[model samples]
Target: MVVVAQQTPSGPSPLSVDELVSALELRTSWTLMRVALRSEKLPIGLGWKDLKANASETHSIAMKLRSFLRDYFEESVVTGERYVQIYEIDKALVATIVNACKAVVIPASPFSSKYPLPLNVNLLATAPSDPTLCDVRNHQNGDISFIFCSAGYYDDKNSYEYGQLPTHVQQTYVGIDKLVTVRKNYYQSYDVITLRTALDRLEISVDQPGRLGSLRFEARPMEILSACALHFQSLQGFGACPPENLFPAIAEMYGDHAAGKVVALAFRTMTGSVKRERMTTNDDDLRDERFHHAGMIAVGQDIKPYEIELDMEFTAPGGIAGVKLAGMMSQLASANPTLHGCYIKAHQFIAMEKALNRLMTFI
Candidate 1:
């Protein structure tokens, strides 16, 4: 059941449950609910008329139903991650919390038959436990196979995009199809050490590099997860999405075995964010110590030269060709002077597919 606020010429006003019922039943302009239990389908204790009434019992049931539905968002089924009170209502209303506006469906059944069939046996056992597996598990071949599917809306058409993930991180990560400008005032620039600090706080792991860009240490399970989460958050504004909790939940369910397998899968896949830009700055504001990048990095005077460092040890999945193409474009922008704009085109599914393929390879 949806509780909608009544709107006036000026703005929306707080509404009672009875008013929400009136709006829903009458299909009034105040109705914002797109889905609700029909009158006939109401639970045993409640009916359409009961919801419509202004009586105490009506309000009581309405509140109870609302509360009951709200509970759905409180606990994660797979990981048991509970939503904080601030986002409780909003989280419960949406299907999957990851990028609410993007309509990325993180499957409920994990056993539904859809596209992207025939998972690899190795990946199935290695994939972090989640409902996402439902899409592949229901298929006849899924017993020995696990599949991960990511769909994207480009312009308006849907297409399959995939990613290649790191071999050792046991997490699922996906990027949105849009670019999000980071709020310069809200966050400080983070280097590898600071980034690791944040990951440790969240109980995530990352590969322990002996030095910057060095592979002396194996990947930290949490650090890889953090990079995936941050990449997703940067590409798409935060909402009810739950990808952040995916890896940890798998760790809890299967203990170290799950964790180890996931990390291996991540490194093997090298899942990272990639985008195309027809591009690109950083300013160190003293008091607040915030970093700001302006225009395109290609044209911007504040462009950091160090970003060009290419540690090619990690292989990008989806396909080598696409990864190489993007890398080439980035290099071209950095070296060429007369180039006006650079176009970097990447499909989001590439990341998802890469992660899935690595999971399959490991399992």
Candidate 2:
């Protein structure tokens, strides 16, 4: 019998790949031009009309304009030194010039056959809110509860998904489809006003640390913390986790410390913690507390008659406060069996924050 060989799946043809790369490059150039024009607030002249009028010319007007800008910028200099020179026409001006060139080169309709790639026409457009995407319920006590459900959960009998979602949402349905896969299992709700107030407090604290003492925690702290966790996830790449799972996980980790009292969470670098340590001669000097801890203190009766206050602290061992938090949680879980749940929650939060910070740099 003739030996039969196993067949492997075929990849895209080279021509197809080349076409995609070319299309993507063109799209990227157009996107950069649009961003530059909007950011610099550059004025568009009658360049397009002039180009159309000179369509019969042997040499295109667009090519002539581009050549002129290149020569002008190359010869211009603001400061000349032996080793270094600064251009008189800065990056912003160069961007403006490039955008002007694009006005002549690119057609007004981005969907034209000249550029085969799909153009994001609404890249700078202000998105309209979709009421159906989120459900907001108002309580008699004037507190509003908000629940953002994945669009897939509300699919019609015909299996057609949320037609009303924004165009971008429709394009990435494959990825978003996973988010609503188990929507019911992880569905969670939050008090809208309370959440907003907590975020406002966070913003103020970041701006003015001296005013931290005056900040109020009247709203549910879990709502605020959960929102932070969600923001962290969105910035990072954990977009797959549904709100239902994310909120409950946050509540379980820090909920006990935050419950029935005002709680403030802060990160300190490992170097700062080490500098604070006292010099000890003995080898057995108690190792500095490297895990989560809480203490209670009496803050007087004017503070809503609460008998005691909770001060929650977490120690990390690196220069970056976020990294230290992650390391501390790992050490805690390994050393103490009792704090396994707390470690899980804290680990997730720090990991999310790190991911978010990475994502911000790209933006």
- Which TM-score value belongs to model 1? 0.16
**Each candidate: what lDDT?**
0.24, 0.23
Query: TM-score: which candidate is best?
Result: 1
Q: On a 0 to 100 scale, what is the lDDT of residue 15 in model 1?
A: 46
Candidate 1 residues 1-363, lDDT tens each?
A: 345343322344454455444323322111111112321133433454654442224456555665433321111111111011011123232222223324333344322321122123333343333213222111121111112222111122233333334433213334533222332111000111011111111111111111222231222222333333443343233332322212222212122232112111111111232322211111211112122123222343222221111101113432210111111223323443221111111112222223222222322
TM-score of 2: 0.15
All candidates: CA RMSD (Å): 25.5, 26.6
